[model samples]
Target: MTNMALSGHTFPSATLTCPNCQTTITYYDVSGSSYYGCPNCHAFFKYENEGPPEILTTFQPSTATPVLPIGSEGYLNGQFVRVVGLLHKKEAGSFYRWLEYMLLRQDGRYSQLAEYNGHWMVIEPTDHTYSHYHVGGKTYTINTDEGQYWLYNQYKPELLNAVGEFDWNCLEDEKLTISEYIRPPSMLISEQGATDSKWYKARYISRSELATAFGIAKDVLPAPSGVGAIEPADPDDRSGTLLAFTGMLLVAVFVLQVILSIVKPSTQLLKESYQTESDSSGTIKPIITSSFDVDGPTVLAFNLSASLDNQWIELPVTLINEQSGRVYEFSKTLEYYYGVEGGESWSEGSRDDDAVLSRIPSGRYHVNIYPARDLGKPVSFSIGITQNTMLGSNIALLLLLFSIYPISLFVNKQWHESQRWSNSDYSKVYTEEDKS
Candidate 1:
């Protein structure tokens, strides 16, 4: 293969007559030596060292028309380029077929535009050589051999059709070995053959972007199917951000709760004793406590202590606002029992119970207590009321409610990750035991 700089040329186009079909063809050779295929006869020819053209084999004409046709001019990578040639190639052992458009700048620089299943990628030859690459801070090994197990497969792509002019002798059924390393939606491709080894950096291109670059309509391009090797990672995925936000909200709520518990001093409103006799019927006389002023949103807790032997006591209490007649009702139950079972003494229930009312408004309030006793037993109980008491259950419920958003975001992120890795050769669900 001849490598010549095609820049600084002063030729329009070279006219040649094909020796086989006698078809007259006009071709451009900015690279000093180039290949040309007859548009009508589809005969391949090569010219080297600016000499006369030599006839190669004739290939079949392609039925497929490219979105960017040969001889079409466009601006790519800040340079005006013309689509000079097109090669439709397919994998040797697979049904995978792709199109490669050869782009030639006026200054003789060459690049390739590849399309596979409506996915577009632009590959430019790079002067940099490397056995490994650091992409996004992660190191990836490069595979050079044609046959071995690797992260990516080695392909011997056979040329199916050719049109227009190419720098190299583009022939049909000619197979070239290529090795690729991919970090989607970017890839590094190494072309190795009898000629010099070539490296290229490939980046994914969206249909819209390709259309705009080539001055074509977006609908004219085919829609992409499966995920492409160089398809970009979605930047709009904000799962990590949402999880962080939820985590911070949880921490803030916990810190606020702790600060409120330490800073706000609870005020004892009422502490009184009430008794219910065994003969008491229906409803006992309500014990009214002295009125206390509640100045802010506060928690009103009532602690009831009772003495009962193997019996239960129920108390219904109401806190009534004197100014607005607003009423808050709560219930507490007390029971204690002791017995010997299996030669072990055990006690069940407790002699004390408590109830809490949260976020009560500011006002003057008094308590009314009604007591009920079981089995005609007398019960003596004391009631204690305090404001601004912390409710642990309420805090726990709030935390649980706030966690729903993060949990949902996490599940969605996991699903997206699974989709991204579905094409990988290595999977998380596979294990050595399962393989065995």
Candidate 2:
């Protein structure tokens, strides 16, 4: 290939007349381009170093137009480039087809724009290489210097139609073997032939990017459908930020909970003992406690303790606000049963229980206690009330609430990844065992 530096409004050119179609064809790179495919009749011609060009073969003219037409100039990948060539390729054994647009810069560098199923990739030649190994009917490649890239596809592609110019005889009989390796938005491709080989690095590109860079209308670019091989799993740029935000929120809630627990310890409001005698008619009047003052909105803990000998008691309590006449009702059953069975001492229940009430406003409150116990025993229990008790469950609930977006982002990423590898031979989500 020639390395002549071109400037603004300067373009290399050569003109020739096609023998098959008698149509005049123009060449953009004089020293580099030796093959010309007639755009009108779809006939390919090869030009030697010092002779008249020879006819290679011909293909039926296609009705579909290239997205980036030949000779289109644009700023791409930080370079002013011209679309010098376009080749329509088909898989050797399949009906699948794609387009490859050759781009030439002023610095004599070449880049390729590959389009498949409306997805675009910017590919550039590279000097990197990798070693490959085959196992279980799959091919894998390892690049010791640049890390691992999984093999995606290996196939032979035939040139179905060609237009504009190329550096080599693209229609030559020597077959080419192409392999693709992918690592999500990045790809490494190897093109091996009988006498030469080439390596290319490709990164995914969006339709809007190309349209903006080339000053083309966005509607001219096809809309993408299924996930591309090298397409990013998550399109949202804020996924990482969201994940970090969730993690920081969890930490902040935990730290705040700990600080509040230390600085604002629980304050006992009331602690009193009540005695009840067993009554078969259940006519015992309830004991009412004195009014306790609650300063502001807070959480209240009601604690109960009792001494029993193989007996149980059900304590039903009602808290009434003196100012508003509002009532809160709850119940707890305290039991302590012990026995010697099989020469082992065993206990089944505890004699203490507690209940929590939240969001109580500033007011004076009193408790009405209703006690129900075993018919043959009398029970004595002490009741205690504490205010401003820090609850860990609140922090847990906050963490769960804050995790919704991050978890949904993760699920969306996995779903996109699964879609990307759905048609791949070496799928990461589905193994051979799963298929069986």
Candidate 3:
């Protein structure tokens, strides 16, 4: 009896018996090349255009079962296909190994799926040469001859195991020469040799998509490790996005500050000069200033200048909102000290002091200044008040708060970049130190 699988298209089938084990196997000549392996005894065979099957050698059956078993069917690239063969290959001098599943459509077309470290890639043969290829609107140049020189032990790929039917004469000892060029999440591979030359386009696929396509549970798949040649950058990487958000927030803060400064203009409300006599008591009479109208929440800035040589002056002033009887008090200390240290004269404090009172409500306000002198001498000082002054401390504090996001984003980006270049030859963190 001839067993067959049907897809969207149909093909003529053939049956042969393995000479070594006498096991009956049924398959299709999708590529016209007669090469097959026994599913029961794992014996390799080859057939001519019209001849009996010749047994080459028996190979060891792989202990591991494929996620997509033989005879399993699926629809891919608008065509129905069935898994026909599986080849386990490994690079020489390295532990890197991959599985290639040979897929055949009922219409006699072939496709390949390569998997490495849990990463999947769908590869299809293309007539175009590897010299130039276009993907995602970008043209890439690949040189198979020159690339193989730098790649170590790349051509010697050991065929670990295989099953099912195949188109070419599959051999375990044959070394495959391969050249590859990667453009993150996608790659172009060129297989060239003395007998045949072929180019293939490889695209990365998620494990979830592969599991769903193969009708398998996601948990059965292995977790991916390291960076894949065609693995895409993480979409959830928020470094750039967070940096952009921080920039916008900073701009908004600057614009808000500018608008606030424009809307609430700082104007000189009062300027007066007063003198304190030493003959009077330590507490001088309060100097009453002219009242001014505040239209909104405002900042009152008081600046005092006094001529003092190695002396300090403490002036306490109180602002009274006459309409609501709200009193806002502030103090300013002006000191100018000069002395000779190590035969050099230096001055420490300035003779001017500034004090600011913020969030003063809308009302008529008056300033009452009480002056006191440390020495028994009279001192003259000038007083000035400005409304709606900008607070430097507040702006500085807000700027610091807004900078955290950008700093964090920069750090994360640097970390990711380091991870990307960890496998490179010219890495930032070198193994040896440079003495020169």
- Candidates' C-alpha lDDT: 0.73, 0.81, 0.71
Q: How accurate is candidate 1 locally (lDDT)?
A: 0.73
Determine the C-alpha RMSD for candidate 3 after optimal superposition of all C-alphas. 6.8
- Which residue pairs show backbone clashes in model 1? 185-230, 185-231
lDDT per residue (tens digit) for residues 280-366 in model 2: 777665889989998668899999998888999889999999999999899999999999999999999999998999998989999
Question: CA shift at 214, candidate 3, in angstroms?
Answer: 3.6
Cand. 2 TM to true fold: 0.83
- Per-residue lDDT of model 1, residues 1-436, tens digit only: 2233322222245555665677665455544537776667777787667577787777788766688876677777787777777888888878788999988766677888999888899999988664743222122355444322123445788777776787776652354677777655567787776766778888888888788888899999989887666565454446667767778888898898789878887788888887884335555556677888886688988888998899998888898999999999988888899999999999999999888888889999888877777766578889888888778787788877977766776676566456645655433333455344
Worst 10 residues of 2 by lDDT: 1-10
* Candidate 1 ranges with C-alpha deviation above 4 Å: 1-29, 38-41, 49-52, 132-150, 171-175, 194-196, 235-279, 282-291, 296-319, 328-359, 366-417, 424-436
Error of 2 at 391 (Å): 3.2
lDDT of 1 at 26: 48
Between 1 and 2, whose lDDT is larger?
A: 2
